[model samples]
Target chain A: MKARIEADLPFYFGPGRELFGFYHPAPAASGAAVLLCPPLGAEQIRCHRLYRQLAHALAEAGFPVLRFDYYGTGDSAGHGRDVDWTRCLADVATAATELRARSGAQRILAFGTRLGANAALDATDAALAGVVAWDAIADGAALVGELDRMQDALKVDLNRFDQARPELDVRLEWQGFETTEHLRAQLSVVGLPALGPRTAWLVSKGSDAVSEHADRQGRSVEAIDVAPRWDDIDRLEMAILSHPLIDAARRRLREMA
Target chain B: MHEQAFRFGSSRHLVGIVGLPPVIDHGVGVVLLNAGMVYRIGPFRLHVDLARRLNALGYPTLRFDQSTIGDSGAGGKLLARPEQVVADVGEAMDLLHQQTGCRRFVLFGLCSGAQNAHSVAHADPRVVGALFLDGYGHRTLGQRLRHYLPRLMKASVWKQWITRKRAASGPRPPEPAFVVEPLPGKVVGGQLADMLARGLKLDFVYSGGVSRYFNHVRQFRECFGRLADHAGVSVSYFQESDHTYVLRGDRKRLLDHVAQWMGRHFPVTRPG
Candidate 1:
């Protein structure tokens, strides 16, 4: 077994170079590049390690990979409140371009999890060769509802010993990240867009709706039981380092190539 | 503000971002440590927000991940997690010193990061100050009374107690996979005394998340006794904020408080 080389080059690109990303240049280029679109907020934090691992795996398998934080999140410029769904889509496109330019790979494949998957599907990029949607969100309203439930549950857990404080009349926010009214409206209307022929749907075992939706769209779906529960409060701090998911993504991208 | 990404360390695998101001005003830069497993951005991007704010105040800031965390790889030399963290942080200071000519530094952290900050500040003579959010605290008699008395007066508490007693006979909830043990009061007090004697400025902020062990402002005085009253020590207790400061308002309050504290104690000398 050879010791894997990690992504050594970290750079800023996109408009005003506001976006931060790590480029994992493949020792042997496969003529295809992988752009990892990360999930939003807390989900992004949970998946950070998994994404890094996936990037490494993809790079070793001969594809250059670029993983980045969308604007208003992570090391990128802007605050959490500035996060917009449309902006996320644009960032995905921008990152895909950056990855193509850096790797000199004509074919670009996007691998995104959760909301990131949705962004990849919706992004209008000419260079996108394929997409791997891992547990992609099919319904935006459902995600909002789930996040709201998690927020309420978190309050109950934090205030277990004391009486709950009066709810503050403030803008929509979940966990620590704030969502603008525009983004909330955008999320509420999110539904599965038409899947491309090269799209790969990797969903959790219990997510029958996503699989059925893909099947209805004449798209095949791979159900993996090892997918991390992104919204589980108990394992909020735990990183999603599921090897099965990482391997499945790598294999899926290789098949696409 | 200028932000630059860096990959430095012995193996040149450690990753960090340095936030620089247009004009350098202070000789002491700020270095942020990772809070638990979360990356260099810190929980809710707190480190990024803090670094930018500190830069606006004319102080350079570096937030980096420890080895095996975030983008950072394992060190070339094999060492335990504790020693690796200390070494990683020292290298961060060294990087800032080399890049920006910062002779002294202030360390800031939250939760586990706070523990690391305490460790590094104690070991490194170049650390001029350390700020800890929801850091170490032991339950003193005052804290225990403050935590329980309000609940004892509430009727809902007794009802919940009765409900829990009935439920306790049914089934036990699964034990947590991990538990955080609080540091001993005696040891923390002694460490604080030593740091104070060395003229290290210390700031402690307790949030509602740690209310079980630290509830009121005076709990600091009761927990650490004489050391809490030292001129070099300052404490703030925000009973409304959770451990991670999840709420946007809570996070803003935290950032503002931190900036003000830095301005007061570690005031940046303006360039002529």
Candidate 2:
């Protein structure tokens, strides 16, 4: 068995706010730390176990790992409607700082899944040594459009509010979590920007549109086509790990001297 | 209701969250165990919702991961052991007793968690009641007939049988099997009898997904003999719900039912 210490605690990122996270400290100092930014809403619920497994594997491989829920997600402090893409990026930065201070690591890495990947690339700080974007959403407008399609597909009567009534917040509720109008608009404008990290890996389905966009903006990214095992609607209860994606991330982090 | 995160156990590595009501219920609190690989939050945040509802109804609840599961780190052992799970539940109970002066407890769990809760209720005298959701039990001959007979009548089954594309696909890929260990049906029945003999309240809730083994509402009675009709034992079957209660409506129904069951069987009265 691998030797590691897990601390499940909340840290104050704002004056009156606290964010919950799990800190996985490696047995020996690896001089490098990784902050895992998770996807929001139902995706976060589905991937919680896999994310923990990734953190454990990373810690066992001698890297300090910190995986946390954004302000309004998981066991964190806020409600579902309070989360936005901007605040989530700030949460990532706060997590990176905490990981560095706790692990005494000089360099940091940001790894994210889906929309979390978007946040990681957008929130690259000066201390970031590498970035791993796994099946990231390429364009926010397209994502919003897809969400609209999903809402339409549901075709069920809304509990109270309706899209026909423009006065109310045009909310989209997926698997019990709702995205308010303000957050929805913010998400509509999000896309991968040019990143500063030299070491980067982009894992996507068949194509790396986000990385290609980043390349156009002068950021080099090594893209790997690996199909994700995520089903946004269907609840996946199995404890299966994506070997290819994990292996790719492990190999990339290992190469980040 | 308020929630606070904490780590308990000798190593202080087991992580849990305590949901407390406005007033402390010093006599009894509910301890929710992990179901299969699902974390303490449960599928679709069911555990979180259930804890809040229980607390609002005056019963504090503690939901946590075992030594090597969820947010908790590995506990020197690689494979999951039932004995370890049982001991971890005891530690959670001890923590609740120390923090809020809760002496009596109600254990609640689903699937493998239900099995573990059953084992713990039989082993520990402190548990006043236990709720098992989609727990294990043997299928009767009538149950087998009711379950398999429906599949033969499905249009999709006949289509598959005629097309045989599944056969031509060269053996369909193996699904990732659920790894949780199940207690034998006889053993579970015996343990339930023992718990009831000691005056422990028990509730067995089932979903439509377990229809293969538990086809009808009366199957529990048929399988457990006279023990099923015991005053201490209660059984509920939600024929429309899945194993994990994926549907939001189903989850809400489950929460409501569990809360009502607790009110009737394991009501918490705060000590004045």
Candidate 3:
């Protein structure tokens, strides 16, 4: 029998910044801790319920989990104007350190979805035992292009009637959330060469960019195909737990353990 | 405005953010309830923006997650009953009252949140006013004809009808699921009458998202009987905006309207 304890606390990740997070402690230590990195904008709101469920499930499986919002997002301190890749990368590293210190787990696994997976890949260091990147973006330019297409699909043109368009330095709007030009530049050229020995690249159906990139690098990667439910614009509020996806990720982690 | 995160409830499991202005001796404060499964932040973080604006207006607000939702832990159970939600809200009011000495409160909620706020207002005497966005509204016979008659006279409707008739020979894809659950009209009407009789201020707003059931401005009275005509009750419909004010302009309009309504009904005054 496993009893999980959950706490909502703030992580002093940086100077004058506090990131909000929920820590789910397992009944017994599996010597491994997981940090959940959420995606940005509407995707974060839509997948929040699923993330909580995943945290609970992982805790039950003996992996202490910590799920959090990036700085300037969710319940965290700071404004939208401050969101950038540098800050996001630092936040991830800080969250992992906090989890390691709190859970006393010798091994650490970072799980990220979408842009979060991109951040996870960038934040991965020697201490990270393994990584589970779900629906990751391998190329930053492609990610920005996809976001542009998604915005067009949603019929959102923030500057449609503006006779005078602002410069590229101005922030861009993504599905009602603000993104700075600095963040856009960083995301335009992101690349994930290949994962280390213990890495899983979960790609959506009809797209294997990450897997192909890994293969091109002459590296072995666990490429698992899943539906792109995270990008679903319609059912963003519906908490549809994909058992197959969860089971696949779980199997990979179990093998690592 | 000063904002702080705190927890209060049985076993201190409910987590909430209390927004207080520089002055804390206000008599009437505000409490924002959660909308369905959406957390205390409300959809698109609307509640946060609303609370900040209200605090600037010198009215303290407390927005919290119901047990089993958001940052709050489950109250020793997986599912929370309706009564439990009301109790949690009452506890929030109690906490705010103890903190600010506020005796009167105005409840704000949207969608399922509107239902919860209405329920709390009905049960708690401290709730002086309630603002409901995209709340429960029903259609009347006249409204039904008014809605369909225009389409009946449309050339596109007839053309679509003929096209569908021609395509009826082929297999039809199952109609996609569309869930619509409107609250009971009679019960809401009775409650409205009672609240109005006690001098309770009511602001009920419906956006274009709920136009399927409530389209016309006069539909409230027709649907819920004459009780909707009470001077204490105000009904408004934003036909162009959706259920959640996704557009920035629409949200500004809503906030302005709410600020004006709050000023008129539950004005925050300096303590003597």
Candidate 4:
């Protein structure tokens, strides 16, 4: 396969260069940039391929894109146990500034999936032209509850092989990554902030409450049919490649630009 | 430790992260391959953790995705997947050798990655050491007995078996995209013998995740016969850990075991 004209540049940013990200520069400048906020832990992993594709698409459409790992996740410098909602928000703001500098874009739109969408909304950055919240978590407590259920189901599935296996400490972990009680407590109260006029809320068909909430705030809401099964243990290895979602986000971001 | 991300390969489309230690005490760098569709950070970031741990011990490490996976772009569509993977790994070794002055290398992988590592190690002379996690394995008589005997004693197994029999048949689940085709015992034995004869260090770790194919410590010997008895061949059976080392405790145990094995086989000669 032929390489793209604009090759992505991977580098570290943030304090002490602790945060890792890739800068997908637009071949032709649109004066706008997109910052991608990844979901935490395993969700971030499963959606990695999709995110890369999204970044490439956005860049091809003349929007420089910055896809990054929040502190204490992925190739970022901090330990997994240290990750928290507060750190994620701060990282988002830092990444926005970095993206603005790297891409020389005056307007920066943020696109986040799952919990990362929450971070994008919560982050207070003036450079942010808008935010695209895809399957954004409306309730942190509910997300935690779903994660707990998934972990329990995983344990049950594994028990088929070894019945004597001891219960994993769910409070300290969700899936395979390390988590902290502090993080869980912080996540429990997380709610999407009041939507800005430019903010677009993309939800799966079932997330009516989130859609209604966005509509009540007079923000754009698009209900997508193909929701990514990020937490499914059976399809853990399958990468999320929802063309509909990608196209929707691309179209929305183009409109914003 | 310092970690830097860059693109390698002839097209410079393949992305990788190289973890460098404060001091380079060993010439053989470790290359962590992608496990299934999981990216370079590995499932649960096992590779990043392991890379940093190994770096702390002064062994440089590189974790990258092959073409058409993760951040890496596609390779030549003309080449088969296996050939592309082997070619990608050779390019990874070339990058490490050029950047770190490491002439020798140790390849590490999980599941599909393990199979790739084995193949690459067999093909590339620069690969002086290789670690395979849940790699190739065939069911041995002892392994089958150990796996099924406990289930036979459990009433729940029989109950489930009956329940499944009574249930209506539906669509069968699609076969997994990546399956390790077990090599013939003779073929594996001959390959291991050749690698061992070249003074290559080999480590194999089988988790409880692969219990269907491999169970008990002796299964390694049962499957490979006398070749598994080689001093250079180290085998670990984590009957409690799953295929991906999902649990924090299991992952810690694995990381510890890998570090110990690497230290024992490829000691850092210079004082860090």
Candidate 5:
């Protein structure tokens, strides 16, 4: 039985900008509420279907889940040209706020993919009972480098475009988002554990070195190599909805509250 | 986000299994990369056990078969090539990203797996860090010729050719070495320098079993400079630990050091 999806959700946390999201409200009393923050760029695209499925699955299991896009990506708002540091994180807090207000659930769980996971982990003031990252990009620089590596393989160099760098070291905005030296420095020191206290961490490794940081960080990190579907787009959306972990996460969120 | 099967790239099949501690969704993930081949962990269970223990400690882990081996997709040739392994790692990372919305990433592996983790972190600053390298070496063939010249020079050229072919292939590409002494031998100094230049500050602990390759710690000293420069990196050698910490022994110290070091560097948000 399909209830309804609360589309075009709006809320503000940090900068008070009207951020956007899509909410799935279940028919029965919810077990827990989950707010899913998608990774930047293509991960959002690749995991789109998965997140939707996760929302639906959680709803089926008595937990309400909401999946939404960040400031500059997807159909949310703002031109699709954001690369800023602060705005994205603010969006996370906003999403959490929206989930809490709309779902009216006691505890909130933030589930993110890749950069989205990093964003969730970076959030502090938000009242999230538990946080899970499908596979998180702990280092924003690494995600940039992974993309850079792909570009280099394809013979492209974006760093070279920063010619005025020597003249203008001021915070340069790539896309509509500006990255400040301060933000870069803050991000550099960031690890998953920085997400404040009483946080639940999940690092998905298909049994590989990707789990190294999880092992060291001592956060309850696990490697789940489930069938990875979805292409460059809608990957997280689809997995979060249909995957098996949603049930466990829903249970944890309920217990934490 | 438990034990799930997946195919990475076109050739390598990957599995993110529950470790000993079963970190569940919020755990450390380890991606095992075989030197010349991508092997499965379901049957062997060494990597599986490692993943389980880490899982028990709230660390999630994964190990996948590289391209052209096991039941994975087809990943061209040069299976264990640096770039190739990196690509497989990228795929696994993507999978991990899909399964867990983790912000921080760490790597722990052995042999080429360890080397791959180091290189990924070195090139990509985003890597929280890495821990591995049961066998560390630093030497080129030409440099070795000088040291072994007096003896190797006396050997026949035909014998040299055969030895070269065998040595070129990584020892125990698919399995751990049973015997510790009769090591497959390792290159020293120059060669190690060239390969490790790409690694970031990957903090790790090496067991004495890998001592067979290190004639002098100084030979590989240069590699540490770049690592030292990285933001969060540390490394040490556990003179007594083996490749895989034996379950019955006091192996927890090394891994615990890793866990503690992780606690000191990347603090996790404990359930408050």
Candidate 6:
């Protein structure tokens, strides 16, 4: 239980900024290190409790984990634009280094949700260990399309303001807010399947084709819907304390042994 | 949209569920090509709900995962080829006709599946019309190459031997299971893209062009456009919904129109 808690470990990537996170070092000889990437937009907000549960679970299991913010968001470096794949991946790399140096764990893994899953899978060609995705966004194009549909649903007409290639940056009367070109560019090429080495895909619920594709690729897949755990704020604290990943750290160490 | 389960090929035709029909036949049939990896999906179960709904409206439909993608599992690394899909549509039409004596049937597809449907409906006379949900155009290797640079560069990006893959990769809780390879010169690349290029996929056809995601959206549009001109027979884009925008009602309407078009085109001879 005397797990070392490193809050906001500052790690450098490029010349731009140092990304950070809170590392919960396991109580025993550590098993491995896991960097957790949160979801995108609102889902990020909704899954905070789940991430906490995941972090505590990993810690209890004896594998220290560092769940950090990308360059700009959270307690990390920059802004939303700073959250692009380039910056996000760098931040993840930096986090892995920090975990390895501090805990001397031989293995490491990337556990990501939604948009974060893209970064994780894309990291297959990176160093460290394997990657796992939770409801990973297999189709980046779909997410962009969703944003557009949501924009339409929101009644935002970017076309009304300027006739000739109107700048989407400037807030148009109809468009609720300016849409960023950076986010768009990222989504176009965003594909987890293209990323090297297949990553495990775990659906929160329902067994569908994506998971089947995971199986085809020889990746482990499990779909467990834990009664939709995010809504229980009062239970969030307790839930985090008894997370499965955290509970399996010692067993994870035994596997390594 | 509207469809009924009926029996055709002798009760000993294929697997279990001895014939009456492997599926409900309303004389109307649609060969659905899911984007890719259909075996992992519940196509008949998912779209069957829509079929059941459509059947209530006096129409019968069949939504089967193309060869390699779903339970049909007959292709190699990819799902059925364009020509093969066309052939399947042919068989499905015959099955529908023989079973219920309805001649009219439509071929409908979504994303990459749309391309399959388009190719089949154009080549075959039986499929009078087509319905495309999130239709796509085309794709060239060069365009794909340009898009893949970021990944290539990011791969060897370790500062010495210290770092490995991202730290966040770990096993996620599993999902429930109900459950459920390759030939030479078969398509292979980025896993999903290879699968799609081989056959079966979707894109912005399901999403928007947020600047961050604009590349994906535009690339998809370009790919869809590429395939459009070649879609010989006329195909209609009904109920265009973004990634989050799948309107069941609109999809139903699209199916209704498809059935009507089939009736006008194929002219099924009613049983005497």
| DockQ, candidate no. 4 | 0.59
Tens digit per residue, CA lDDT, model 2, B1-272: 36777877766768888877888858678999988777887765678778878888888889999776777765544434777777789889998887778899999989888888988898888999999998867789988887778777787556756666667666446665557657677887888889999999899998876776786778898789899789998888887666776555667799899988888876667622
Off by over 4 Å in 6: A1-17, A154-179, A194-198, A205-209, A226-257, B1-272
Per-model TM values vs. the true structure: 0.93, 0.83, 0.83, 0.95, 0.39, 0.39
Give lDDT tens digits, candidate 3, residues A97-150: 888888998788877778887777788442567778777777778778766655
Off-target runs (Cα >4 Å) in candidate 5 are A4-17, A155-190, A194-201, A206-219, A226-242, A245-257, B1-272
Q: List ranges where model 3 is wrong by over 4 Å.
A: A1-14, A105-107, A124-129, A155-171, A180-182, A193-198, A217-228, A254-257, B1-3, B6-8, B11-13, B71-80, B98-101, B150-183, B225-229, B270-272
Tell me model 6's lDDT, rounded to 2 decimals: 0.46
Candidate 1 residue-wise lDDT, B148-232, digit = tens: 8888898877886787789846644564343345567787888888889999999999888888788888988888888877899
Query: Residue A50 of candidate 2: its Cα lDDT?
Result: 75
Ranking by DockQ: 4, 1, 2, 3, 6, 5
lDDT per residue as tens, model 6, A78-120: 4333346676676667767777777787777767776777777
True contacts kept of 1: 0.52
Best by lDDT: 4
Candidate 2 lDDT, tens digit per residue, A42-119? 678767877887887788888888888888777776666678778898888888888888889988887888888778
- lDDT (10s digit) by residue, model 3, range B71-165: 67666544446677678888899888877888888999998889888888888888899999878777778768876777778776677578768
Worst 10 residues of 1 chain B by lDDT: B171-180
Docking quality band of candidate 2, CAPRI definitions: incorrect
- Cα-based lDDT at residue B248, candidate 1: 74
Residue pairs in collision within model 4: none
Deviation of model 2 at B268, angstroms? 3.1
Q: Each model's C-alpha lDDT?
A: 0.83, 0.74, 0.72, 0.84, 0.50, 0.46
TM-score for candidate 5, residues paired by index: 0.39
Those runs of model 4 whose alpha carbons end farther than 4 Å from true positions after fitting are: A159-161, A164-166, A195-197, B76-78, B161-172, B175-182
